[model samples]
Target chain A: MYRYDEFDRKFLAERVAQYRDQVRRRLAGQLSEDEFRSLRLMNGLYLQLHAYMLRISIPYGTLSSAQLRGLAEVARRWDKGYGHFTTRQNIQFNWIKLEETPDILAHLAAVQLHGIQTSGNSFRNITTDPFAGVAGDEIEDPRPYCEIVRQWAALHPEFSFLPRKFKIAINAADADRAAVKIHDLGLYLRRSDRGEIGFAVTVGGGLGRTPILAQTVRDFVPRRELLAYISACLRVYNQYGRRDNLFKSRIKILVQALGIEKMRQEVEDEYAAMGDEREALALPDEAVAAMQAQFAPPAYADAAGDDAELAQAAASEPDFARWIERNTRPHKQAGHASVVISLKPVGRPTGDCSASQMRTVADLADELSFGEVRVTHDQNLVLPHVRKSALYDLWLRLGAGDLATPNIGLASDIIACPGLDYCGLATARSIPVAQALAVHLAGREAAIGPLQIKISGCINACGHHHVGHIGILGLEKNGAESYQITVGGSDGEQAALGGIIGPAVAAHEITATVDRLIDAYLRLRRDGEQFPDTYRRVGLAPFKEALYVAR
Target chain B: MDDPTFKLVTGNRLRDGAVVYFASAGIWTPRIDDARLVEEKDGAALLAEAQAGPPPHPAVGPALIDAVRDGDRVVPATLREKIRASGPTVAYRAA
Candidate 1:
């Protein structure tokens, strides 16, 4: 983890003090609600349907044990004893008092965390692969680059107020775990033919309202010119992106209006125009080296590849075996595995972690893995450096804390947004629907196998329903809650938006509709096919017929 | 057409961010039953009045909610509002 320098510490302290004064003024009636709205949003505060929501950025989804403990303390003291980790790898406290927000930010600063750039029309938290350093197939760990981007984008004066909120994601792994293709700007870290490190940059990919996968704008930019190229891309967007219409304000819309080729040309021209000044923006080799050194892989013990103790435990306990298969991923380092501590337990709202659970996971991270935790884009926690031998003991600890639910990549492991429950923009209830579906499919999850069910309350696509294998979008039709289903969506190497299967079903019929669709997939799927693969192979006709046909 | 008359003035409390309703005797209460249901024509006036006075009570973005009287209790007409009035539809906290 990157420790804060004196400059970083001072910046956070000043920001907290500034926000504290702003909150005071707003509460004292010196600042009107209209005047204070943007200021609050800039600091990651939003007044939602039922209460205020404070989104705290967990930069690149990386947290040390002490930081996780700090978040647990925040949840216990300031919130309703829990926090919701979001798809953006951020955590949101839904019930927040206006007066307590400054104090909360101060507490976060003590842990070297801040809510800055988590909201507003600014660069949001830069995301990367959760298994960045440990993944076997990775070209290089993307966290150093993510950290560099984070530092550069944090309240950049010129780009602070863009046409809309901008997001950047980087992936160095062969497998796209970070969902980089669906970001405003996506970077793939690669080595050129000459063996020099560079980036493959994609621009204008997003999911909300108009979901578009990013187009590759630059084939490769060397490590030195990385920041300059990114600056050029932002410059083009800031200059041309629509400001009048909020709906058409994102860089995606700009890319659509001006073809990707034209947009690339414009960015290239801007880069050229900067001349010698652009070189100043480019990060020097020493700076890159320093950042990379900070993110160096943890020291590993010279142990045998196969652990006899782990093998014995697995053979003896079927439950442990199931958990190991479902919750753990192969690591680059021998005898080490990345364990996913599932936040999705049956019948609970997805992505929510209680104060005690947070503390427990923090302790587990310290004990079993390195004293670091990674938050997945799917709203799960990752112990990225767990030893194979410690799997059973870690499982027992996690099970006791209600974190070891062997349902990773299963039907019950649904990703859902805080729909009508918290968001004012939501037209329907997403959490309840997700809960109902999880419970309905709890027994059949193993048989169903690796089906992603994402439910978004509205078209904002906060839950990423657009890219779910079984996407459910909640809508308001006439005066009733209706759910529109989309199938064949995926957020992977081959990313594609789901197509709607049939007419919007009523809230009560959503579960049954999903059940029918699953039954159809099971019947039509070939051997070893996932739901998405089967859906893509058979198309929507079979599933649509199954869901809509009268019983 | 959406019913405008059967409305309840709702806002979150500034001090604690609790969902609150503008009730009778010009007070803000967390209980929905204590809410004063106003006619469509009077809704705007009542909402304005509720938002006019306080820094502590009904803080920001106070608006009139389309609601109906279910026996003696005031209930939000929209599903979204219902979820807001009550807590989360699903179990929000861990067991």
Candidate 2:
């Protein structure tokens, strides 16, 4: 939770004024509609099928209770009482009037939030592992670096207009929770042999008409030179990147055309030419120091909290025990447990938050845990630094609020984008399709086991359906809502795109099809095999047969 | 689909223009009374720019200016979409 300094405050104020003028001109007919479209896009406004949709950046999905309350107020006053949290960890107000957008942005700026770079062909909101500081296996917290990248990329005049929208993700933990491989640039922060922090950089990952797992551009970029390396890479793409063909305009396409070795060499050459100018990237250590301070674990009594007593408590509350086993994880400090607030309910829209629910989370954070919340790339929230002494109490409160679900990295948890309900580009309804599938899957709750089901409205792959153990893509065929299923897709230490199961099924039949596919996996899988493992073992033939079986 | 009516709405080149169409709820409405022919300066710049790429752009939707036939008179396909997003610039209606 980095507070905006005077400089940051002034910068946002100026941006607000600029956008206000842009909106005024558009409305007054001073600027042509076509000219205003680009400007509006840069400000994160889109004229969709129904009304204008405004996307507001949540900045790596971190929010204060006050900020969350601000969002709740926005939903109640301006929007439709709920906001759709996006795959990029941003939020979208789907039904905003064209004229009221400037006021919306002004309100957001008041809370140090703006929609800049949320759209257009610019640097998108940088994402990281939701369990950054709390994860047991992480080397260091990745938020400071994420913030640094945010400031550097926010208005970088040279690289503002990229050939295509670019996404960057960083992960410091052993598990790649950020899905680093599927980004324009993915940085893995790991310690070198000498115990110095460094990044393993990869480029060209995306899931659109063209789905590509980025190629590794550098094995190691020293901690001090991370910014330089990134600037150099973007410069290389900006200079030689294709503008002639929109399809081939992405840096990934360029990287693909020029081979990894050639691309790496070109980046290195460009970086070398820039020369080490420390002044250009003068990140205030004090700013990062303050952010780290904000995220520091609260003071807890130094005691394992009577292990025998805890074991007895676990044995008593089976539900609580299950939640603790699945949802809670070890913290660096004793008597503290890192808590993950599950967004997946039995049958709710994935990554959706009602105004009340959002306020409750904010209040809970303020009272029980640290005053900080983190949004995962997977679209869940994390109270990373919580005291174990407060564990049972936190669980009780969360359970009352329906936030206490014992399914993390499990089958019931799903990632879905707002489809036909909100998104204008959508051809079919993804949320309802996901809801139906989740409802059906909930029946075989125990048998489903640990599986990842991600659904997208279309092939843009915003919901990351391509990388789900079982992927569902909602599409329209002759005005009928149809869904295409994919199996064997994964986004872990070793990532792979899923293979299509068979012909597209009607939206109504998707749930049954998915059930049959799971049944096929269950029948074919070896003992104790996870869904992904089973899919890898038997391939798609068995699942395909099961999915398309005639009633 | 019936023969699509088209018109020139805005931008010198179709590639640079943010061409929208008559979506379900009329997200794009007509901005003028009738189609306006691309002025000489704009037309030459558009042709020069169009050489960078072809017509009927991708990503957002179809290119409206692609229907231009008579150097000046906007074809039906472009006219229909222009009127839909911005409005008609001329009094003449489809015969």
Query: Poorest 10 consecutive residues of model 1 chain A by lDDT?
Result: A300-309
Worst 10 residues of 2 chain B by lDDT: B86-95
The residue-by-residue lDDT of candidate 2 on A1-551, one tens digit each, is 67898998898889888888987776565665667788888888876533577888888778887888788777767766767677787888755766777788888888888888888777999998777776788998888888888888998898888887889999999988888888999999989999877799999888876778888999898767778889888988888888889888888788889999999999989887886563465445565576677556556556577445556778889988888887877776666676778877767777767677777788888876667777766667777767665677788888887888887777777888876665556766677676676677776666667888998887788989989998988887875678888998888767888999888889778777777877788889898888778877788887777755745
User: TM-scores of all models?
Assistant: 0.97, 0.82
TM-score of chain B of each: 0.83, 0.22
What is the DockQ of the complex in model 1? 0.58
TM for candidate 2 is 0.82
TM-score of chain B of 1: 0.83
Tens-place lDDT per residue, model 1, B1-95, is: 64343877887776667788887545888897788887888888887778776453345567888887767777788777788788776667842
lDDT of 1 at A391: 89
What's the CA error at residue A356 for candidate 2, in Å?
A: 1.0
For each of the candidates, what fraction of the native contacts does it recover? 0.62, 0.00
